[model samples]
Target: MLEEDANAGYRRLFDDDGLTFGAGFPLTGTNRSTPPIEEELRLASHAESVGFDGLWARDVPTYWPKFGDAGQTFDPWVWLSQVAAHTDEVALGTASIVLTLRHPIHVAKSAASIDRLSDGRLVLGVASGDRDPEFPAFDVDRNERGQQFRERFEAIQALWREEYPELEGEWGRLEGDLDIVPKPTAETIPMLPTGQARQSREWIAEHGDGWLFYHLPERTLEDYVADWRDDAGEKPYAMAIRVDLADDPTAEPEPMHLGYRAGVEWYRDYFRRLEEYGVDHVIVGLESEDPEEALSRFGDEIIEV
Candidate 1:
């Protein structure tokens, strides 16, 4: 089965037909100059109206001054809460949050709250984080984040299920006679782990509801999926890819980070391969010079496949 079909949260988002497209924002502005969350919500509603299935935001910290794209330029949860309220049925997601820097309780609370606010239309993609520059300011060690991420991830999961969850780890201790209120409508939020983050395949499969991966060749992705299935028992996985469409529909492919600069035809072929290789949904990131047109083109051309 495809990844969306297998994951409970994804199935809820995309329904039975499978593939869905979501627009990632700042919908219209840069990190340094975000217009307003309202503009993004408008774009999101537009996307849904035009048949895109979901929308996602990025968690960009102020301290990471040069990350260029401050991604949506707002607090992810708060922005998602607004979008959830305004839009009727679009799946709202955080393309990812940097989990290593924040407390597990906060992650649990914010994600649960968003899920509730959206009436259960939230997809939580989390990661160990890669910005070494921001770690010191938070008083967190850059080198130790991988280990910290594991401990915190476990704590959050426990908090979701076990009342008064007590966590003892090298990072810190949460000995709680307290339970996090408002567990996800599902037993837990559908958390997708990005890359390895020092987690073994066994750990990812057992812990992660799904895999959030970057680029891999078709054969390699198939192998990775098989390995993940073996380790995870029965779980789903997803990938994010960028497409830069040329004005010419037959432009040849050129490599970019985790994606390509190619024509819509190549994109169609590439997406088909991803599906054939068992990807349930390919979250498309349009980073072309023309964002609106790129989005329109993807919807008009490739989504038909």
Candidate 2:
């Protein structure tokens, strides 16, 4: 069986033949700039109440004016822990933590801590650095991000699975002398690599517990899923989409950044198609003036289908 098939977080949020849904954080309408984040906890709890399988938080360590987006506007670790306290039974995920910029030890410790705190509900999505300015700011070599990402991933796994693990790489050197505390609730925390992370498709298929990808057209997504199944049998495939659900139930789809602006009826059909295409989960970034109403409507109409 695939690691995702066995992971507690994955088990809670996905099934073999059907699709589950998660709401991205900074649930408020604010994007493009720093979100106030005042209502995130309340909205997250509501998402769980409405049967959302997971609540995703993004890791944006610094604001990049050029990038034009501030992901959740809080430290992912601190924010996730706070959100964990307010909700029950909802999987808490980091859409991705930039592994190449941070030390592997910290990522391991923090992820394990969240996993334990959430009672094995942590799904850690990791990535290589993306924002160009961030690499130089953190003093990380942009060209070496791929190598650093791989090394960090390996180091994190060893720390979680072995006691006093001895690891040597660019991240650091660990000689079986020191052990990282608070190992994941299970043998290891589920790690889903986001995007390519500058790694080969084969590498991701072999190493990741699951694959988290950006939104794609139906045919494109179907092809990607087929390739993934061929390479990594039975592992889950997840994607993120930005949606602006219209008030009219029969409104047709119009193109948006990563998704579409459509009605609840249209979304229901769209999501059913996604399920048929073997998408295991979707992390939806909702764009709405009244986010609460949109979320409730999506849960009642789309997710229940």
Candidate 3:
């Protein structure tokens, strides 16, 4: 039942009508190690009920001691699967999971498990990781991930598709006709790499079902998309924005990290601008002092768009 409705929702957004909006996966932490899972689920359900088309989970394994922001404050897969069970329609996805740290076989199994449990409402985004400390903790080399990411991606793809497939790589070797069970209902899980991780835009374009980017000024974003399309031949593009909707409906624009604190009117205008620029999806991160208020207010305004 959940899978049926979730895929139906996916078709409604991408297969049928084109443009859609989603809230970036929300975690409540004012500089903490993690937030309670219960709170995360409540926030996720709020986004779904408020008409968010998708929810993005960030992977924040260790505190990384030095890194200031601790990202999404939970294990991405565990949190996302719990949220998936709680909601029926909103597509559950990772903003970008660091594929370098974990083995590809494990990544394949976990992702396929979530995809099946969620009834095919899964969009798995992969990246080579950015933080420096995380590598040493796992006794993995930070420098070698770029090469590993490519190899791992290939292995995971083969594991998902062919039964009893053999895979060879520097990372590890899979021999003797092993078949990964529980394939994704979709032909492939959406494998979007965040930014250029030691790969050229041309290479990224040739691959990647879609492109993911941080927030940029509307005109700059337009130019960026144009450049991406020029290199990409013809693939969809997506971007995420950190949004902090002020309680004051008339809140004016103020610069925030990767986003702006603005009123609902400006927010709508901004999304319309993205639509005009031919963007396929926009993931908004509502990071206000009061997340509930921010989500409620944004839902009343932007979700209706």
Q: Considering every candidate listed, which one attains the maximal lDDT?
A: 2
- Candidate 2 C-alpha lDDT tens digits along 92-155: 9999999998899999999999888888889988999789998889999999988999999989
Error of 1 at 190 (Å): 0.9
Q: Once model 2 is optimally superposed onto the true structure by TM-score, how far is the C-alpha of residue 274 displaced, in angstroms? A: 1.0
Better of 1 and 3 by TM-score: 3
> TM-scores of all models?
0.88, 0.96, 0.91
Better of 1 and 2 by TM-score: 2
Lowest summed lDDT across 10 adjacent residues in model 3 is found at 1-10
RMSD of each: 2.9, 1.5, 3.3
lDDT of 2 at 88: 83
Candidate 3, 1-305: lDDT as tens digits: 01232333345345523568777765454435566667778888887777778888887677866777666777778877888899987887787888888888888888888888888877766788888888999888888888988888878888887777788997777786577887777655667677775667787776676677789887898998889878864456778888877667677889887899888878788788787786777788777666666777777788675
Q: Write the per-residue lDDT of candidate 1 for residues 217-260, one digit (tens) a residue.
A: 77889898778777765466677777678778899898887778
Give candidate 1 misplaced runs (Cα > 4 Å).
Answer: 1-9, 13-17, 63-66, 170-176, 217-219, 288-290
Stretches off by above 4 angstroms in model 3 are 1-13, 16-18, 29-31
**Pairs in steric clash, model 3:** none
Superposition error at 161 for model 1 (Å): 1.3
Model 2 misplacement above 4 A: 2-7, 32-34
Model-by-model lDDT, in order?
Answer: 0.74, 0.87, 0.75
